[model samples]
Target: MATSVKNNSLPPSLISNLNQVLLSRQQHTIDHQSTNSSSLPSHSRNVDEPDCSKPLLLITNCEGIDSPGLIFLVQALLSDARFTLHVCAPQSDKSVAGHSLTVQETVAVCLVEMSSATAFEVSGTPVDCVSLALSGALFSWSKPVLVISGINRGSSCGRNMFYSGAVAAAREALICGVPSLCLSFDWKKDVSSESDLKNAADLCLPLISAAVRDIERGKFPESCLLNIEIPSSPLANKGFKLTRQSLWRSPLSWKAVSANRHPAAGQYLSNQQSLGIKLAQLSRDASAAGAARRLNSHRKNVEIESVGIAGKFNGQQTAKKYFRLELLEETEKADDNLDFKAVEDGYVAVTPLSLSSTDQSKIETEVSSWISAALGREQRN
Candidate 1:
């Protein structure tokens, strides 16, 4: 179910009267100081400690703690005055580092600020940030009602989901049995536009409010994730679309399409058996590059040309590097039903991902029968 909010005013009424809610059972440190303290962080209107009277909305990312889009997002959330938005993010950009934890190494943490918003920069992956927050390392001694990851520079939709550290952060929260949202902003010609970012932040306001409502109502789905991709296109009048992820093989890894342009690429190509195959590879790479450039463009429709190169092998001379940024995937009904497709179509794409799936009931599925079979003895025996 979708939730909605209309006002952005600071809720003074909610602030005057604090509400103490029980924390959900999740991962955290058995570390001292938190054992007897309230599950919610102490509320201070300073934007640093913010408000303990309100629930916590922990924002995080793989993008370094100092992020323009992230700051803008925090400002937007603060304006609504719904919850204390404490930022828990990486100290540095840990891109594509999926769900990694420094089990044996000591990961440092420090307090930081994005303008006036109070934030904590963790010396680890996005997942580590979530872990630390839940453990009562960031807040005074409270857990957040909701977890938000990213406002990422590029789309973390479709295949990117598997490799994106941003999405991994949200996944981390979900695994801890908390509702989470992975927010992303599409790139424009290899850069993230301010207009697109601001629009994304604006869009997030309502979504955040809705999510908070669900959290308070205890209606949030367990072990589920919300992934939102805001396109480079301005979403002034657009709405969000509930869509599914598109299919792309091996989305977790990058595939090289063309190497002919690079100095070493030509040498590698010459090593191939046929010149025809070399030319074909070059053509495919060029096509992919052109397509990517257009996709990154803010314009909806732009003509792109296909290119191909052949001949010569020398590792000495290098050409421009080109790659296909595997962002969106195509489906038969990509217009409305796919995550990346919706982003490209200038609408916010909302995808729901769950941690586990169901299995059908069968002879092997029966618990009693499985236990008996495992013992290698029949019921009679």
Candidate 2:
């Protein structure tokens, strides 16, 4: 919204009701996170790369859990002996929180004393750290099969695929059916070059080995996803295209200033229910929308002077706040060679998403006449 939240102070109707309370705790928080599996992500038992049947990945990001495109994509998926890096991110930087969560304070899940992936650090959101790591709250007998969210420093493609929290944690791992792979990077990639972060993790190691070979070949499609968008010149835009998800409308604006010597503006006027309220406004859509138009009018403005009061306000302190702007465009435009037109014609774009679009032919005639006129006004009162 407004070029991906020029800034945010949480309240897109409370992050859309915390993404419907983390999609109604998808299947009862997977038996309370597998009865608290020692806060998941800590089994680096590499006795000569002991492959205890590898494939638990579950990495995440809205840029937290040590972001550097998530520690360079967890050191390129730990030299991919077939992925095992586990992390449940978001202890901060819940950028443009889409599939929100952390409903009603206090949701900490720390265990990031890592030696090399199996990390956790969730105060929440990034779909509440992929709903507390696929509802095993943080994992014991390792479950994720594959979740890899961002390689996300920028470029989720076109209107940022509706305010990504790394594409809503790969749409919360395909709504718990699990088969996801989001990855992003191109806002001119160069993420402080370590050979451009290993050429953007060797350009997403073959789409993370083809999303773990389409979830070990079950190949889902009943509302599935595989986003990818790389290209701030990754070896000159390697190659990838097969898109659909373009709505064309980017040039967002909304400016509001002064938070009075901002110190989280006194906790953004004392947390009116903050799930990480960060709003400092001003962005120029990476130079008026993708494919770098080179309108480098001083790299077309991107500011965040202040406003990041999500937690630790502890209430009872006041000062000031200024807000408004919650975008959700898409009135219609089924497809026009989408996914930002294959990353603005440089290739690398793959879009396919689903999670109830609800136009099942107007759900039996216009959503059953508004649910039968609200149940006929509660049975005529």
Predicted structure with the largest lDDT when compared to the true one = 1
Superposed by TM-score, candidate 2 places the C-alpha of residue 311 at a distance from the truth, in angstroms, of 34
Extract clashing residue pairs from model 2. 8-278, 8-279, 33-136, 33-137, 41-118, 276-310
How far is 319's C-alpha from truth in model 1 (Å)?
24
Per-residue alpha-carbon lDDT of candidate 1 for residues 118-226, written as tens digits (9 for 90 to 100): 6778898898999988876556655678889978877676676878899999999988877888998877765556766777787777667766765687645444577
TM per candidate comes to 0.60, 0.29
Off by over 4 Å in 2: 1-58, 63-85, 97-117, 122-147, 150-157, 161-180, 183-210, 213-241, 244-321, 330-336, 339-349, 352-381
